[model samples]
Target: MRYLKVIAQDRSGKGVADTLHVEFYEGDQLQRKATEADRQRLKSFSKTYLKCAWFNSGEGEDRHVRIFSHNPSADGTPETVRLHFHEGPVIAYKAAAHDLDNDGVFELILSSDVDNDGRADRTDRNRVRSLVREFLRVGW
Candidate 1:
């Protein structure tokens, strides 16, 4: 059996949670020893993160997890190790456009109730909308 200690940190490189220790002996064996730097790179390599469950701090800080362990695959079948770091809920947003004046130009309508609160508020939508709009306008 092999054991590993995975420590998660925030975008600022601050520890977010205690080290998550896990043990596994089944399935294919681990391929390599993931280091702190490797973990950081992995985290940062992710272009985007999952959205929050509901209205939150809107601080999508980059998170990194460092796995401290030793490879135990000796004379065993070569296998690959893949890791995915998800911080929030699995969600998607919807938007539409309406021509109020019927003149052809349509005003954008965005949904803010991603959490299904039954009410549309700016809490959950502003951050994402603003960021996207800014990126489109300023070419970020």
Candidate 2:
């Protein structure tokens, strides 16, 4: 009974705008793609992708999140796998209300950078500085 929170990021690790554009990942094994429909479907998937990530009493690497095992050979049994979510930092910029699990309203996520390299260590201060410079430019 978990839902997902969608987070979009640019290569420089910035949030995406609300217009619902998408970035696709593909390989040579792929051929002519059907991305228009795929893009629409992706939004639905991304929104709930992180909902399964939850921690118990404490936080950090010790906390593990269970994911759908997708193990189907069903004689009617539940299958799941747990992964150390702390290993990868999550960047959450927004939240929304849901009655999905009846968990009462909004679900959330916090920012962390366990390794602090690829993860976004840059903060609002950096963004503010950049915007100021962009606005004060001498030439159009």
Candidate 3:
């Protein structure tokens, strides 16, 4: 597994305000590690810090993950290991551009999930309409 650290501090002081430490691991195997320092230097009074990683899998497909863990084994190792799994909703999201009322330039067509199941039905026009309405309202 790989380890990373992100730190956030007050802009006018020299003490750290918050820190995020992460670890990256492959299906049971460990891979590359990353941290915010890998990106830029943090001033003693910085406001925020981020440690991110973009992992590439060798299985012919592409995937990404955000890691969060907090645990330390006295032997001098991290204490916790956790990975979150996210799957796009069934309805997914598609795009279209047209003035439903044909007024002028496109109305910025969009879609939303009405079922509230966290997934949208890609093929259902009603579902698509629901998504569009939601998008128009809050751009969700």
Candidate 4:
């Protein structure tokens, strides 16, 4: 029997980080589905707040959620969403592990603007380069 599940999708790629649809599932059935109808319950809901996204396994946890902004020019602008299946607060970070890079331990990937464009793309090489530079500045 399946014990845990997650569902997320990006909504847009224009300005800031927008809305995402998420849900939980068990077995082969969907337990919850975040949809437009449910979003109406919120104060401000716009199509700009929703878009398409992709998901990949992050290091150091069973799962992680990375929300990318709507900037075609910038990649690596993911708003890391921490998920804790238990009861209290659990923090999740962008990390790398042995299975991730053929290494044994885990490496943590911190948050950095990397790009000066004020937005992040999902797989931009330049943005990732900038992020690495900023992240490794050291003692500054």
Please name the candidate that would achieve the greatest lDDT relative to the true structure: 1
Residues 80-123 of candidate 2 have per-residue lDDT tens digits of: 21112322355222211122333322122223332223444444
How well does each candidate superpose onto the true structure, as a TM-score?
0.24, 0.24, 0.20, 0.23
Poorly placed runs, candidate 2 (over 4 Å): 1-9, 12-34, 50-68, 75-78, 81-140
The runs of at least 3 residues in candidate 1 whose Cα sits more than 4 Å from the true structure, single-residue gaps closed, are: 1-91, 94-106, 113-120, 138-140
On lDDT, who's better, 1 or 3?
1
True-structure Cα RMSD, model 4: 15.8
The local distance difference test score of each candidate is: 0.31, 0.28, 0.30, 0.29
Ranking by lDDT: 1, 3, 4, 2
Name the candidate, 1 or 2, with the larger lDDT value.
Answer: 1
What total of clashing residue pairs does each candidate reach?
A: 0, 4, 9, 11
lDDT of 3 by residue, 1-140 (tens): 33221222233333322332233455455454334653232222122111111122222112222223332434432233222221221222233434434343334433333223455354333433332332233210
Report the lDDT of model 4 for residue 124.
32
* Clashing residue pairs for model 2: 3-51, 4-47, 4-48, 4-51
* Model 2 clash number: 4
- State candidate 4's TM-score: 0.23
